[model samples]
Target: MKPSRLARDAIVLRRAPFSETSQVVDLLTPDDGRLSVLARGSYRDKSTFGGPLDVLTRGVADVQRRKRSELDLLHGFKITQPWRGLRRELTTWLAASHALELVRAFAWPRDREPALFDALAGVLELLDRARERYEIEAYLTSFAGRVLAIAGFVPVLDACVRCGGDVADAKRGWLSLAQGGLLCGSCSTPDRTAIVCSDGVVRLLRRALGGAPDATPGTAWTETVVSEARRAIDLYVEYRLERPLLSRRLLDRAERSPSREPVA
Candidate 1:
């Protein structure tokens, strides 16, 4: 009998040495949300696998699933976007890492999410050419909101979660990560929620609900809006996902110049 063959465009999310000559790769594919594949003899041959397996590369891969969990043998691969330029810039590198980490967190094997995959590809591409920190921040927050929506964690940013009142007037609200979204001023006290959000912050978040990957706060104002939104989205993502993203942490570390304190 012929062995099962899987082929798709994949983004390398996480990769590590499996043995002396092989590697374990976590992939986010348009057809398969997140899957682990082994690249056998990649490190040894350095010809077939080459170096496309590096994290953040966009490429095509041929993988055969196995009963064992360690590594999937690679049959073929073609590098489409090496993102070599991004690797040279630490900020861009960390931003791309955070995006991939989110992909790894929310998506699972055989769960097709073409839009999210494309968003990720676009963001990684942006990181490759990124010139501003604000750009990456906007993209990451918007992409996080979009992915959460795709995974069905769409937060209730528009109205009260309890009484269904318009969130337009509410001065403050609570966000229940387990409950999934905002509790207006009225319902929050009853729930004794863990995290509360200001109305301005919630409105900023509402702007994010539309899933505009390139939309940052207008330039007339300072970056305070962008900064707050980024923190809120980061906290919201941590609430829903498996763990805090390593890339986000790394990006934060990189952005903190020696002369300044880290922005909250």
Candidate 2:
């Protein structure tokens, strides 16, 4: 039998050159977690795909899902949303890229992740319109929290992991990545893998992980609070994933450089 033909709404997660004229593209579909398809002659003059097959673009993908253990064929991809704003600013680009990296790490081939995919799309859309660095960071932070929680890395934040005492009831709590939660004043050890955090940061994290990562709390974010909250989430994610995301590292460096500009 011929390979089953499928056309799904997908987002370009990543892509690479293949066989000079062809390309290997990674896509995230609402119904299908990730699809790796070979786009034959996509770089040719008479290519079936219009424009460049760029990353982070959303489109309708015409694919042939093979039965045997082989790469699927991509006959066509009609770009729907270029999301050009992703590359309009360095801060936004880095945030968008890091989010994609996190998605790639969590998404399994052919597995369904509809909710995660929707969340990702929403976050990307918001990132494109974001002007300030803090706004972009908030969107990414929220997305990361959602990704981590979905992947079964829920950290206990309301109370201390060691003593089970609510941090709100104590003077303060220490964030312990290894123990995967907060340690109250009485429960924290001198040598534990704990980072001192403020009550405001903890509240920000709680709101972010709960949902609505795009919802801005105030007219403008409390710069310090949002930054600290974002940092804590990223550290937790890195600790759980056991490897630092290269995009995240680059994002940090780019953020520090005042002269950096968005790449076209």
Candidate 3:
């Protein structure tokens, strides 16, 4: 039987050159987790997908599911939000790219992740209008927690993953990526492997994990939470992806440099 073709809205996570004139687009759709589609002849002049394959660009796309395991065909695409403002700001662009990289790394093809999709949409908007570094950081932090949650690696924030005991009173806690959640002091061992976390970090994780979608703490704490949260989530992603994230390294360099230019 022929695989179904669907019209969906998607975010372009990454795009790579295919042949001399085509491009392979990796996208995150609401219904599909991660999809690789071939935008035929997109690199050539007079192309329909010509100006819309940018990372972080949202669009309505026609994707033909594949019978085998290679790139599927992109019958058409229409731009929703180009997010051009992000391009002018280096930090925002780099940060958005890093987030997108995580999306591509973690999500599986043909899986439904509408919540993750909505989160990404909000993150992009936040990155675009972010005035302070904390805003960006907060969004990324929340993003990391949410994405991990969506990927089935929900951390034990409300209570200990092992004993199911309340963690609200604990001053310091440990998060185990390998063990797959939080470990209490009694349950923790020398080789159990966990990240040292403070009350603030724990609370932040708890909020992101448990809070309502529309509810977020004010932007006052956005930066601090975002920075700390980035480190924490990166640790989890590093363990899960099990390889060096090239985009993260690039982001580090971008963060340090005086020249805030978007990397091509």
Best by TM-score: 2
Off-target runs (Cα >4 Å) in candidate 2 are: 1-3, 214-221
User: For model 1, what is the error of residue 83's alpha carbon versus the real structure, in angstroms, after optimal superposition?
Assistant: 1.0
Task: Provide the overall lDDT of each model, using Cα atoms, as 2-decimal numbers.
Answer: 0.72, 0.82, 0.76
lDDT assessment of candidate 2: 0.82
lDDT of 1: 0.72
- lDDT per residue for candidate 1 within 1-264, as digits (tens), equals 745677779888888888787778888888757778888777875558775368888788898867566445677778888887677666767777788877778887767788879888887776677667777677676777777777777787767667787667776767766666787666677674337766665766776666755445344223555666677777778877646767777777887842223121
Off by over 4 Å in 3: 1-6, 162-166, 186-189, 211-222, 262-264
Which regions of candidate 1 fall more than 4 Å away from where they truly are? 1-3, 66-71, 171-173, 189-200, 217-222, 258-264
Task: Estimate the Cα RMSD of every predicted model relative to the unseen true structure.
Answer: 4.1, 2.2, 2.9
Predicted structure with the largest lDDT when compared to the true one: 2
Which RMSD does model 3 reach against the true structure? 2.9
Report the candidate with higher TM-score, 2 versus 3.
2
Kindly list the per-residue Cα lDDT of model 2 for residues 173-240, writing each as its tens digit. 58898999888887777636787878777777777777756435343458777878788888888887
Task: Please give the TM-score that candidate 2 achieves against the real structure.
Answer: 0.92
How do the candidates rank by TM-score, highest first?
A: 2, 3, 1
Candidate 3 lDDT, 40-81, residue by residue in tens:
988778888755377788999989887786678998889889
Alpha-carbon lDDT of model 3: 0.76
Give the Cα error of residue 88 in candidate 3, in Å.
1.8
